[model samples]
Target: MCMAHKSCVSEADSAAAAAALFAWGANSYGQLGLGHKEDVLLPQRLSNFCEPGCIKSVTGGGGHSAAVTGRKAKPSSLLVAKNQGKTCALYITSIGSGNVDVILQRGSPWTAGVLIIISNIRRSSLLPPFMCLVCCILLLYDCPDGGSLFVCGLNKDGQLGLGHTEDVLCFTICKPLLGCPIRQVACGWDFTIMLTVSGSVFQWGTGLASSGRRLCAGQTLPLFLTAKEPSRVMGLEDSTAVCVVAGSDHSASLTDTGELYVWGRNKHGQLASLAAFLLLPQRIDARCFQDEKVTAVWSGWTHLVAQTETGKVFTWGRADYGQLGRRLESPEGQKPHKQDSQLTFWRPQSSVSLPLCCLTGAAKISCGSEHNLAVISDKCFSWGWNEHGMCGDGTESNVWTPSPVQALQSPSRILLVGCGAGHSLALCQLPALSEPCQDVKVIYTLQADTGNPESQNGMNKERNRKERQSVTSTQSNSDRTRNEGP
Candidate 1:
């Protein structure tokens, strides 16, 4: 997914010059689009880009990468957020024109406009070495001439929405959505969700309610689906959704009026409860927010993070990985057990306790498989799994509370931070180079400070100049003596 995934864009027009792309990190499945599968510690530039346009968005998930290209003014599709399935394969879904945009410079990889990659896995064992999964749900809002949706990757279930059971090597348009102009899309463990411009929501793919023996009466698998087509979700028939986000097994959406609805799996309180899974969209009780209007919400594999119009953050669900930003420590070295009554909260609760110390200034936040990151007044802060140094903190220690990524402080005033499975991504600004240039100027001035005797170089140069001037005057005087006084 995004851990194995990286993406970039060029502000310049490709017709005048080629768009550049840069990628680094785990590339075992060719998620980096480097022509071969290999892990790179340094950011490498990629050449496989669509000509004549600029990159709108890029997404990587489950070891696969997808990019969207469009005009600068167009409402572009969502890039991949990085999510993996049991197959352990790469799924690349480009939701724009057949052409794509991925740019990278030769020496500069962490440039401006770089989005964080998000990748994750089902409860499986065939994963890479990175701990903590970052949910890389493919959010492709592809709108071509016909504005059809396309998806490809491992399709054990019809998660690709191609109306077929086979895995596709290339993007295959969903025949069922020929004329529907989709505006937003998000993916979960094996399902895809999107909100059309007409304010309709649709979904396709497998859910646990259908995969089990007791088919939940009306739902079944090859479960919770009838065919590999984008079917309208009747549960949201009357709701006008603005955007949607898919967790590993659940989904969350916000309405134009700041209303939030959630559905699908809720095993670890992913849907706001530990009791059972949500089969359809259900409006969460207003009491969860003390009646505050919610502006946005996001779901991780087992935890949920939400934001209110007032700029406060609330979290609930799993607290095992310190993802909840709270201390769920067990005795000594013992690992925390899920469903531990004391550790697990069955309701939407406040953040890891307020006055969040280092992260008190968090403006926006996102959830990874087991970590969190946020943008705070131009700085990036993080907590949870730092096993892969994903926190950018220059250490591998797990942070139970919010902390600043000291390594990204000085030259990097981060604009955004993306948390992926066992890795983290960020978009930081390139501050003005005038500072370094000014430093050089200062050095030059010091060398010319002959007024100070301590300035050895300056003093020597002054002495040499005087000696030359004195010798010139003596030579002139001697010439006059020979021509006139003689």
Candidate 2:
């Protein structure tokens, strides 16, 4: 059983410096990676990252954190930046002791210039004894090398891809997947699935079709979706999938062509259907907007959201807790609206309103266990499940409609956004300015030989002087703050 997940990258890298920050929740077993067992309600920068060669990418599991860095290339000696221009490198780092284990690698043939980190966590009961076992297991995979599928966590239903349903505490290499190279893996609460470079889907873990109804509970071995029979999924054969994401009971896929497909538990209309489950992939049809194309897909515990190429956002499935971001009025409105019964199969629904329709450019989108977030034109907006202030609106009110996060107002420019079960993460881009030095005169001698007299005389000298002074003040302020430290 193989489990895989995908994340987006921010495109603001420079030759000089870079930084990565994280925040987490539910840290009973030290899974928050804060070097402590307390849950954090706000974003906190990881300690001891003041060095130059910092992190480049980060991924979070149930309770564990993983990062890829460029620090290994640099020697132990601290290389100071000349002219205040810092040279950056990458390094892999972690905190805490239990629940999950992370590994980082650089100079890979497959990814070439890319840096990758694989994170694996062993899911177990929250009891003290179980927690200790999980911690011990996390130590083994502190660092993994080469291209291999690392398996950890609950194997009760073969979700660990170990060919058995026994619990696994340590990370184990996956068996050869029928000689077919596995490019990625994804895990549901009790199931695991893999996708090959050829766009084939293989699944293992509980609730599979095998077991002759007696084994109907779950399986402990890999099962091909097209092995003995054809999958009921339509329009999947020709589509080239770029990524896959899974929820507790459902999963979603985004193709290279920007098409979205979903399957699994449909209760609460999550599958957009009236049936109980979709045994196959179902393409989401948004009507007249079919050509819009989906650039990203995020699956939550009981709901799903998709971002289109035109910056139009659409959500369907569960709306009970307002995860759909659709406004619901009382039954006594101008026209009575009937609540659709819980659906079990895949059906299409529309969520476009004035605000969403007016949105022109959306760069990224992420979904929490129940909430939804998006970075539209470098601005942040959130909706659904704000009980713990995960929406970052400075309040715990649940919003049934999309609302801009006020806490992230002026000074903070959000470069990237990520959403976890009940928490959120943001990478902010601070303004850059140079230090104030001796004011050297930038002489602009007028060319007396110019044919036009107006060209020789400086146009709007007062305006130009004022602009230069304003720029100098901003640069001086920025320099002072940088020297003072973050």
User: Largest lDDT belongs to which candidate?
Assistant: 1
lDDT over C-alpha atoms for residue 404 of model 1 = 53
Candidate 1 structure, TM-score to reference: 0.62
The list of candidate 2 runs beyond 4 A from truth reads 1-55, 70-92, 95-146, 208-235, 286-291, 329-355, 358-360, 433-486
- After the best TM-score superposition of candidate 1, give how far the Cα of residue 203 lies from its true spot, in angstroms: 0.8
lDDT of 2 at 163: 64
Query: Candidate 1: which stretches are off by over 4 Å?
Result: 1-146, 211-227, 328-361, 435-486
Candidate 1 lDDT over residue span 89-208, tens digit each:
122233212223332223321112222233433321223343222322222333233254555555666776767667665444566776777777776666777788878888787544
TM-scores of the candidates in the order shown: 0.62, 0.62
lDDT of 2 by residue, 243-306 (tens): 7777666667778877677766665556554445666678765452446877766676667776
Give the whole-model CA lDDT for all candidates, comma-separated. 0.52, 0.49
Model 2 residue 307 CA deviation (Å) reads 1.6
Model 2: which ten-residue window has the lowest total lDDT?
134-143
